[model samples]
Structure formats: C-alpha cells, structure tokens
Target: MDELLDRTAEAAPQDLTDGAELRGSSFDFLTGPGIDLAAKAQAFHAWAQTRVAHGVFPYAKRLGGRPGATAELTLLDGRCHAGLNFSSQEYLSLARHPKVCAAAQAAMERYGVHSAGSTALAGNVEEATALEAELGELLRMPEVLLFPTGWAAGFGAIKGLVRETDHVVIDQLAHNCLHEGARASTPNIHLHRHLDADHVERLLKRVRQRDPHNGILVVTEGCFSMDADSPDLKRLQALAREHGALLMVDVAHDLGCLGPGGGGQLELQRMLGQVDLVMGSFSKTFASNGGFVASHDRAIKEYLRFYAAPNTFSNALSPVQVAIVRACLAIVRSSEGGERRERLMRAIQALRGALTEQGLTVLGHPSPIVPVMLGPDALARVASREMAQAGLLANLVEYPAVSLNSARLRMQVMADHTPALAQTAAHIVADALQRARALAGATH
Candidate 1:
C-alpha cells in the first residue's frame, strides 16, 4: 500500500514557462519524492531571472533613500524612477523626522553603534531601559520584555512560556512567526477560524474536556495585516476568562497606527490591561528594529527574558535603534501623533472609497491598509505590473501569503500622502485593474 501510494504521487514533468509561473507555479518542492532540491532551486532562479528582466517581478527594487511615501525605485530592467510608495509601513511618517534622526545620531555617538552583548550579560544601555519602561507605561502593563526583532518576539514569547504539556489555540490567519512559536512550543495545537469566537470556544471546550489541567493559550492579532480587520477583543477576553485560558494579542500592525493616542486595538476596544499579554513591533510606527511583549504577569516576563532563544543568544538592539524608538514613542504619545493618526485615517478612507467607487472589491474595515481583492493570481500579477509601470508602488498578495483565488493589491497609506497624490493613485489603480481584467480574460 505504501509503495502504491508513493508511485501514484509522482507527477509527470511539464514544460515550465513564464506564463505558467505568473498564473501560479505548479511545482511542489515539498511533496516531490526524492526531489532534487538544488536543481529545483536552480529552475526557480531561472524563472525569476526571466521575470526580473521583464520588469513584472517586483520583489525588492533597489531603493535610493528611506522607503517613504515617495521614493526612488530601481526596476528589473535597471531603470530608476521616482515612484509613489504605497508599500511602506511608516504610518506616522516618523522615519525621516528630524527628532528621530537626531536621537539616533546622539545615541550612535554615545554608545558607538553596537550593544557588544545581549542585555542579559552586558546589562542594557540607558536607552534600552528607558524604551522598555516607556513601553510598559504606554501599554499600561506592569512589565515589558524586549526582543531584537518583532519576528523574534512573536516566536520567542510562545516558545519561552508555553510548556510541552500546554495547549495553544491560534487564529488560522495569524502571522507566520506566531504560527512558528505555537508549533515549536507544543504539539497540542488547534486552529480557530479567523475572528470566529464561536469556533474558538468550541475548540477550547474540546481541549478542556480532554486536558483540563494543562495550560491553554489563545493567540490572535490586534489587527490582521492581510485582512485589515480586528477581532472583538471584549468577547475574546470573556471567552478566555470563562475557559481559564490566557489570551495573547499581537498589535504589530495597529499598535501605533490605530486607536486613541496610538494605543492600538486594545485601547480602541477598551481592553488594554484586561488581556493576558500584548506584543508589538516598533519598526512599523516607531521606525526602529525591535519588538516587545507587555504583560502584568511578572513571572512570565522573567521566564521569557531568561529562556527565549532570541533574548538568550541574540545580541540586544543597538543603541541607535533604542534611541530612535524612545524618541518615536514620545512623539506617538503626543498631540502631534494624534494629528498624524487623523491624517493617516483620511488617506485610508479616501483611497478605500475611491477603489470601491471604481467598482473594485475592497477588503476589511477602516484601517491604514486598503487591499483591493482581484481574485485570480494572473490578474493580480498583471495589475501590480501595470501599477508599477504607471509609477505607483504597491504590494502584491498571492499564493502562500493569501489564498490562490483571493489575490489582492495591498496599498499602504502614510500620514504625509498629499490629497493630490492620493487622487492620482486611485485613478492609476482603477486603470490598472481594468487593464488586468482584460489581459486575464484574453489569456483564458
């Protein structure tokens, strides 16, 4: 039976071409029996090289400066153009702020750029301590533990705290790092539908019925970046409390972009201190590299600080990054931050409205991310290519990132995007969608 299954699984080789890849590659490197991994990689490289020469594959274009709302992008054909950047996560536009730059320079001068060792061994610098303390205060948490990067934070928090005997129930659409953390921590993992409280409750009840004594962690995001929607925090909290489980929320996308005072989804939902744990990234809104896990439970904080691999093995965030984050946090808590938040919201609303008016399907509720759902992979690829040709930079979400049939053009809005730019972006995107539709139909 095993041999029969193996024999049946083999796929006949077919001619691979650019058109096939743009429509979605049929290659399955994982399921291929005794597959030549190196050869497959070479094949993919050839395909990518072909696409890059044509200016349709826009993975990473060489950037001249800080990747802001308007910056220079070097295309695949080696031609540089000033493009309207809708791919940046600088919601508050603090990346180029004078104060942020000044703080970084001062820190670089004082600390000389490197931390030299992890915080555990060398002790944290003054800026690191200040940043952690400020984050605790802003998030209204008793303690906060910082990681070198947001990816490390998500992966470390779960792996450090959750034991092998523990159970973790996560949203199906949670970030990839969170999924990694959950899987690495324990084998007893359950997935709940995105934002489906009922599904979570059912899973929780089932787990409780089987292992009432084991610790259960419920994981979710404050604002799902891909979908640009938030869960009902109040309901989720209540459910977790009723089930004797702890809830962890990642506010990486919304922490410094949404809510009053940029307090994030917890603040917007009025559940700041009610949730068990809150984690986020400073890179998005604070314009720095690092992430933190804030919680009232001091034991969990200490455990993560000591056991988390990133914290234990990885070097601490540089003094410059720490300083920049400290300065950005101060601005985010000020009146200027409030004004910037309002401006960001205006851009989001205007762009979403325009896309909808153009008869395009816009996904999610009100947020800085405006994703125009374009269904087919080929269609999304064509639209993105057309948009770039028109000097607009947007992100393409396709297979593995999202469902194959749910490909989208993800546009990120910044607070400093002018009204004229926004209007022009809308028209360009509308035209691109129209052209992509025709091209896709013709190909079919």
Candidate 2:
C-alpha cells in the first residue's frame, strides 16, 4: 500500500508537467531589505504559479454561469444550454421553493443578509437556539449544535469528542472531512475497509490490545455522497456497543432523503436511537447552508458548542438561511413532505431503471443519487460535456473525489422532477455514455 501510494505521489508531478511549461521569474525587489512579508508572499505566489503552469490547478472550468442549473446554464463560451444540474447537493429541490425563498427574503428584510457575528457573540441566539432544538427533535436526539459548514462540523466533532489517547476507526471510503478531522484530533486513528464491520472489529481489538485504556470512536457515513451507498448501520451500532465505542454517522447525503420518515439511513435501519452521534448538512435536503451535530446526550452537545472552533469563531448561520431552514423543516415534517419524498424515490427508481435498460453501469443501491460509472477521467469529462450539450447537467467526478480510474457522473434526483423529465435525463445520459465509449474505443 505504501509503495503504491508513493508511486502515485511521485507520478503526480510528472503528470502536471505533460502539457505545460514552467518559467522561472525573479522577484528581487520583493525579496529586498525591509520586505519580510513581501518575500514570503512572493515565494508562495511563485509556488502557486508553478503549480498552475504545471497543470495542477484544481478549479473546474465553470461553463454554465447561472444561479441554479435546473434548466439552463451559461457555459464558458457565454452560451446558454439546457442544463441538467447533477452537481448540486440540493437533493429535494427545496432551495428554489417559493416557501423557502419567501422565508429567506422575509428574513433578509427583518435582519439583513449576514448573521453579523458568531453564535457565541451577539448573533441571533434565539434563532440558533431554536434551530438546535428543532434539529434535535427531528433527528431524535436530545440536543443539537450547529456549525458554519459540513467541513467544520466534521472537524469540530472529531476533535472535540476524542482525545489523543482515543482510538478512531474510520471507513476507508469515508469522506475526507472525517478522516482529516480524526487525524488532526488524535494520533491513534485506523481506517478499515469500506462498510466492512468485521474489519472494524479487528481494528478495534488490535487497538484495545495495544492500549486498553484508550477510548474508541467508529465513524462512517449514512449515504456516501459520491457512490450513493450506505453502510450497514444496524450492524455497525451493534459492533460499537459490543466494543464499548461510540459511533458517529455523517448523514449529509441521506438526512432528508432516506428512512421511513426522512430521518436518514439510521432511521430506515431502525437504529437511529442506537448511534452515539449523528452529523449532517442542512445544505442538501433542508435547502439551507449550515451543518449540525445531534446527540442524545446533553453534555456532548454543550461540549461541542464551546469547543468547536467553527461554532465559536465563525459567523452564525445567516438569519435568512435559518428562516429558510425553519420553513423547510416545517414542510419536511408534515404529511405533504412525505408525498414529496415518495415522489423523489420514484423518480430515482425510474431514472435508475432507464439507465440500466440503456446499458449504463450505475453504482450503489436504488437511491436518489445515481452515479454513472465512466471509468477513466477523460471519458467522464467527455460524458459530462456531452450531457451538458444535450440539455442535462451532470457532474463529472474524478480523482481525489473517488479512487484513481473510478471517475463517474453523480446524478442527483429531485422531488420536483416530473417522470418525463427524469426519463429524458436518463436518455441524455445514455447517449452521452455511448459517445464517451465510442471516443475511448477509437483512442484505444
């Protein structure tokens, strides 16, 4: 494993140099006397320029310039096309709902655009408190806390909950946020094979053998955003209980999509009450920008509220966003919301079936997110381009998001999509797949 990783790392620089040339530029004035900061800045800028020149730039070219790509987006050529937006995390199409938008607009009128301060500061504590309480109830947790974003939520929870002496076992395919957070928070971290509970048990036993006094935390995601699959939560909960470890599940992708009542995969598995901690993003299903950690224990919630840097330092969620989320929550909790969720599931199934009939390989279970496996990076990029041309907006996910040679198209189905629209999207994606296959065949 180490040798393979080393080889990949060694090849990264070589790959960067294939299509671009790097030129050395001098900055004598910036490095001259009485310019300490300037020298450092110049050095960093030089490194950055070299990276970009060597084809290591990470930013995707934004061809479609639009607020939301449900119908059309203006591409890099400044032309409009019928766009299928598979990249958005808004799984339920609640972002553009009239109720959500109206609430946001009303909140803007009531409290301006920004939160203006952190939650610990003079920001709207009332809204924060209310949101935490509402989230707690929705997630079946005793208490809840919010962070500025999902990245911060993961980082804060792992760091705040575990000590250096604690053993953190994570899924191999867990989101980078979880792995990175655990790595930053504790030195004793082990990664197990994806969704393999037996591997987790083996690692837990090894950790216990090495350090019997150390605490253990097992981490996994409810629905993997990239692959759209879920871990066996019931078995995971039982394993955590047997090992005296706490289990943390990130439900960013499944929070408003899965379960019997839209609570998530844990809920669907009837293990919601078994998991120790649950974290999810409000951005996707709730159609709001923020992240949260929900727990049955009050102490844990209080600890994170004070210890989490993002919660204490970052500005509170904007009042408008809070209002929007509040509205979304109301809608999701009602019977009408159940109907919407059902519609979403049906749409997902329909699209998946159509894609399968068209002979395209789709990953994961029959979830709202249907990932079309395109294999190579070049093929994935070409398929994405073709789909865009055909009036479907799909995301071309490549390396770093998934393993090398596992590039795919991540298609997210929304509740608002009609049957015709969903079928049309599948056909467009199928055509795109054919084109990509043809191009690859010719090249080979």
Candidate topping TM-score: 1
lDDT tens digits by residue: candidate 1, 378-440: 667777777776667788887778876788888888998866677778888889888877766
How many residue pairs clash in each candidate at the backbone level?
0, 6
Clash pairs, model 2 backbone: 63-75, 63-76, 64-74, 82-391, 84-392, 84-393
TM-score of each: 0.93, 0.84
Per-residue error for 281 in candidate 1, Å, reads 0.7
Model 2, position 59, has a per-residue lDDT of 30
In model 1, the Cα lDDT at residue 138 comes to 80
lDDT of 1 at 430: 88
The alpha-carbon lDDT assigned to residue 86 of candidate 1 equals 88
- Candidate 2 accuracy as TM-score: 0.84
Whole-model lDDT values for every prediction: 0.82, 0.74
Score candidate 2 by lDDT. Answer: 0.74
Model 2 C-alpha lDDT per residue in residues 269-366, reported as the tens digit of each score: 88766788999888788887888888988888778877887788888788887888888887887786788888888878888888888888989986
